[model samples]
Target: MARARSEERRAEILRAALEVIAERGYRGASLASVAERVGLTQQGLLHHFPTKEALLIAVLEERDQWDTGGAGLSREAWRLDLLEPLVEYNAMRPGIVQTFSALLGESVSDGHPAKDFFTERYATVRGGMGAALRAEFGNRLPGGLTPEQAAPLLVAVMDGLQYQWLLDPESVDMPGAFRDFLGLLRGAGDGPRG
Candidate 1:
């Protein structure tokens, strides 16, 4: 019972942290703000997460778990077809997406705690995406580029679409745009090469 209660409290804190991070980018969010949201004092919050960096990492991991349907970030979990549903799912969760975007933007700064995590994550994602593309399209895509070459562009489009959608949800149809991108992938090679 005690352990369950502790786990519940930790989850509450993580949710609060996400809200705070979404409202204020990771660089702007403070531990006190997150603790207050969860009805805990800073000291109490430290019992679960010793440092702001630790809390940030936990929040990121929790978000990944949710995205992966609690399967975590397995390479096998990502596929070309699965990406559309993921984007659609993201469209329904603005707050989570906002929080992720905020952290990602701030993570590029020197000495940022999340820089390594994002760097490593991108490498993994690129590899997974390349594998997925290979599985679906064989050696080269319609655009005459290998999966290795196209993987980064695919990641960019997905992330860039999120930023645009977050900035102007009324105007930006993220999932639709992503589907269009996939269509481009299929049809791009059909046209004559320059």
Candidate 2:
């Protein structure tokens, strides 16, 4: 029972931290603010997460878990066709997407605590994308690019689409745009319809 309460408190802290991070990018967010949101002192928060970085890592992992349906994804679970639905799902959760985008943008600058994490994450994602593309399209896609060449493009488009959608939700039909992109990957003429 005590362990359940501890876990519940930790979950509460993470939820509070997510809101803080969404409103204020990782670098702009502070332990004090997150602690206050959870009705704890900074020192008390430290008892759950020894450092701000630890909390950030926990938050990121939790976000991924949510994205992957909490099943703890394996590489084989990734598929090119699944991206459209993922983008659509993301559209429903602006706060989580905003936090991830803010952190990703901030992490590009040097010395950010999340820099290393984002770097590693991109590498892993790119590799997985490459594998998924190869599995679906063989060594090369219909567009004449090798799966290796296309993986980064795929990652870039998805992330880029998220940025555009976040910036102008009214003008950007993100999932549709992504489906159009997939059409381009397959071949033209089947361009984005509506």
Judging by lDDT against the true structure, name the best candidate: 1
Cα lDDT tens digits for candidate 1, 1-194: 99999999999999888878767765666899998898899999999999887788788889878877886767776778788899999898776677678778978999998789889989988988898899989999987889999899999998999999999999998988888888788874234222
Considering only N, C-alpha and C atoms within 3 Å, which residue pairs clash in candidate 1? Answer: 142-189
- Tell me the TM-score of each prediction against the true structure: 0.81, 0.82
What's the lDDT for residue 109 in model 1?
A: 99
Q: What TM-score should be assigned to candidate 1?
A: 0.81
Over 4 Å off, model 2: 1-8, 19-33, 50-54, 71-74
Per-candidate Cα lDDT values, in order, are 0.84, 0.83
Model 2 lDDT tens row, 1-194: 99999999999999998888768765656889999998999999999998776787788878777776774345665788777888888888776677678778878898988889888888878888889899999988998899899989988998999899989999998888888888878766474375
RMSD of each: 4.3, 3.0
Q: In lDDT terms, how accurate is model 2?
A: 0.83
How does candidate 2 fare on TM-score? 0.82
